[model samples]
Target: MTFNLNIYETMALVSLILYLGKFLRSKSSFLTKYCIPPSVVGGFVFALFMLAIEMTGVATINLDITLQSIFMTTFFTSIGFTASLKILKQGGFKVVIFLGLAALLVALQNTVGVSLASVFSLNPLLGLCTGSIPMVGGHGTAGSFGPMLEEIGVVGATTVSIASATFGLIMGSIIGGLVARLLIHGKKLTTVHDESSKMPPTQVGDYNEENHNILSLKCLINAACLLFIAMGIGSIVSDFIQLTGLTFPSYIGAMIVAAVMRNLYDFTNKAFVEKEIETLGSLSLSFFLTMALMSLKLWQLFDLALPLLVMLMAQVILVGLFTYIIVFSVMGKNYEAAVFASATCGFGMGATPNAIANMDELTNRYGFVPTPYFVVPLVGCLFIDFVNSFIITLFINFIS
Candidate 1:
């Protein structure tokens, strides 16, 4: 029998999984110590269950994750909203340094991926699918480029890309926290939140909302207005740009729009409550992640298991070495660098949300550094996708 779930049912299931993950994490030492997000815990467990059922030749289940894109887009829109020019100015040289390094890492990921594919006598394009396409690009990019590879005669491109993205998501989450922990303890690094820090107190979903009635309502409406405007105007911007024959990701226009709005707000001294926007973005991210994990068609991954494993293992090692050696050293070798090192794992391997979650977990344990949070999201959300696409296209052409 085939079982299907509509969007609302799927969301409800996702919420249940989140709650279960939270409960289980509360009971488990390993989960607590590692700082695994509740969504990862629950969504991943449910995916494994579905995988088992498929392996057992039981009923096939499919989910209508239509809402996934909406949530993901909105989550990203929130990141765009957070891109305040004043904060970027404060981030200064370090932010630019990190962005350059991260762009280089995307190229290296494709290099490593293509090299592995060549060594294994697999289709060279298979490595591209497994590389930054899935790793740095996350599920959305995977979904986009996977079929393209398949159309060009790479068998099972979609399956491989999706599987690689899933692997990266889990690994990124696990590794980011561990790396941060090591840096914090080994380097004797700690942070104390300063009111005068360069970071605004607008962490996604975190704020002092003691006055949750009138203020929250007003702020939510304002944030909603701003986000919707960005989304609408951003689409027009994207369309206009595409007409000029220079293509970009769909989210770029919206993000650009939001950033412009944010800076304008800063310039005008408007009371744009960033905390509410952050909260809304956080909620969207949680929903997006849960839907993404639960919707993984693990059965599709069975055929390419061996080769994909080799590729994934190589990618994992590369990200680890890069984070510890280059990312840490170049970002200043301080407490913040260590945090960025951990967050970079997420940036390199998974989506921005994963990177943010990693930072959130570390900050929840240690104190907030704030700088890395601002740096990672801006790079991960705004710039990485732009650079990654170009490099991936270059590699694909070179390899093919």
Candidate 2:
């Protein structure tokens, strides 16, 4: 039997899975410690349930994931809104340096993946499924690029990419602290205590009930309008880019337009509700990820399991060395550099939240160092995606 869900039904199921994931994460120390997204937890469980049913010859379930693209575009568009050059300048030289290192890592990861895939006598594009698409790009980038690779005849690319992303989340969290610990101990690094080094409190998502009640409606409306406008204009932009015989992700144009809009607003002293936009993007990302995971064809992962593991292990080792040698040395080789190395392991393999969590654990144990706190998020959250996407697109065009 095959059961097909309509769009509304699909969204409803995704919502339920997201809530379940949140509940489970709340109850599981491991999930919370690693900063695993709730959607990943719930969606993976649902995927496993579906897999068991399929294996038992019970039923085949199909979800109407039309909204997945919209949600993903919305999330990336929100990220673009955060790419204001003014903020980048405020972060100073370290942010630029960290972003450069991260961009380099993305290229290296794809190169490693492609090289290993050839060694294993697999299609080179399949190698990209385990590359920075999952490692630095996380589940969002994985979900985006997986289907694209599949369309180009890389079977099971989506499943492989999602699985690699999940593995990265675990490994990234595990290794980050270890790398930081090693760096701090090996280098005799100690946190510098200075009142000037304290960072300002973040106001990005401070949605207290009072504040929510006051501004939620207007802010949400404005944010929705901006996202839609950017997405609408971005489709045309994407079409134009494709005319040049280059392949880019569908969301790239929207991201570019959103970045331009954000910088224009920054220069013009126009005010928009950034907090509401970020919250909406977070919600969209959860839905998009849950839908992507729940729709995964888990059976497709079987044949490539060993190769996937080899590629992912290679990535883990690469990130460890890159952080220890390159990131540590380039970022001043001090206490802040140690912390930065730890944070790099986090976002290098997973997402910005993982990076922040890694830094938080380190700061809790030692004293707080403000430089990494300021620079890491600025680069990791706002800038790295642009660099990663550009590099990945170049690789795709070249490989194709």
Candidate 3:
């Protein structure tokens, strides 16, 4: 009844509740099926409950902003860790092609955003930001960078970015799946082979079980400390940018610095706990996404529902068309590569896990991965973000 309990208290409560629920099998069939990431679902659902309480004059929206920031920071720190250069090396030129296709989609996404904004007589510059990057880029990307857009006079920019990212996630999921299906139907799919053509196999059962690897508490702590350091460095770069009369999103620099640190550790073979890295990262993303979605101000969405729906529809159509026509053709119509490429754009232009899940759901049904699992995440989480930022910036400037 009392809402004054701090985050640690809240986290303990949440963990206990979840554990109890799991013990009771209290989760919904839909939830279990989607395996909805708790972060996104939990955060979102909790936020809405807060909103509902506010509407009923029972509570205020003091969203423990500090706690929110920490959760977001952890989520992105995981992102930076997962962005290791080692992934690209493992993935090889498949990584290169994924980046290339993502580059093009970033350009196309802005074109869609700006052009659509122009039709509605809104500021085209703001339109570009609210499109896929911030919207699809998730809360860290949106929250960190959204304020800058507001400072530059983009009204309701935060809301717009959140909405767009949510829409992007949905679109990415659908398009990624659709693209994979089409690819499999059109041609024989191939596994992505590295130069090592003789890639070593992990011990048997290391497949999805890789997601369950345990690591030392010390390593987790070390990784957390490194992420905090990255956040500090991100603040420095962000501050410098603000002073220089140039702008970028808030979390971008932090992610970049953290990514650089992650890569350095990986390259130097400086030991860091990375065994369960991918799984933790994926789980973090899923939860973050679920939380973000559950918190949706359903009312805010009600009025703009028409516009939001239009934007959502247009985004879906555009992403699909591009996936089928442009991406497939450019990637030499290699089914696996096309599937991966479309997913990169789908998520970059859309949602992270949506992109990955899109690929996975299709692969599972077909009984084969059209592309390497590592390929989509490598580009979506790490490489494509930088390119999308550059491309989105270009759109904003071009319209201005």
**Candidate rank order under lDDT:** 2, 1, 3
Worst 10 residues of 3 by lDDT: 201-210
TM-score winner among the candidates? 2
Greater-TM-score candidate between 1 and 2: 2
lDDT of 1 at 216: 67
Query: What is the C-alpha lDDT profile of model 1 across 1-400, one tens digit per residue?
Result: 8888887777788899989888897899776544455666787788888889888978877788787767766776787777676766777787789889888889888989988888889899899877998889886677556656777788777667767886787788888877877776777765654223434323553222233523468779888888888888988987887686543445667877887888898899887778788778777767776666676566766766787898899998899889888998998887788889988998688877678777776666556776787778777865676577668767766666
CA lDDT scores, all candidates in order: 0.76, 0.88, 0.59
Show the lowest summed lDDT stretch of 10 residues, model 1.
Answer: 205-214
- Judged by whole-model lDDT over C-alpha atoms, candidate 1 comes out at 0.76
Q: Which has the greatest lDDT?
A: 2
TM-score of predicted structure 1: 0.72
The sequence of per-residue lDDT tens digits that candidate 3 reaches over residues 173-239 is 6567666666755676564542134433222223332346667777666666776788888879778
TM-score of each: 0.72, 0.94, 0.77
Q: How far is candidate 2 from the true structure (C-alpha RMSD, Å)?
A: 3.2
Question: Tens digit of lDDT per residue, candidate 2, span 1-400?
Answer: 9989999888888999999998999899998877788899999999999999999999988899999999999999999999989999988988888999999999999999999999999989888888999999999999999988888798898998999999999899899999988988888886654323655433222322124524478779999999999999999999999899988999999999999999999999999778878888878989999998998889998888788889999999999999999999999998889889999999999988788878877776666778888888889889999999999999999998
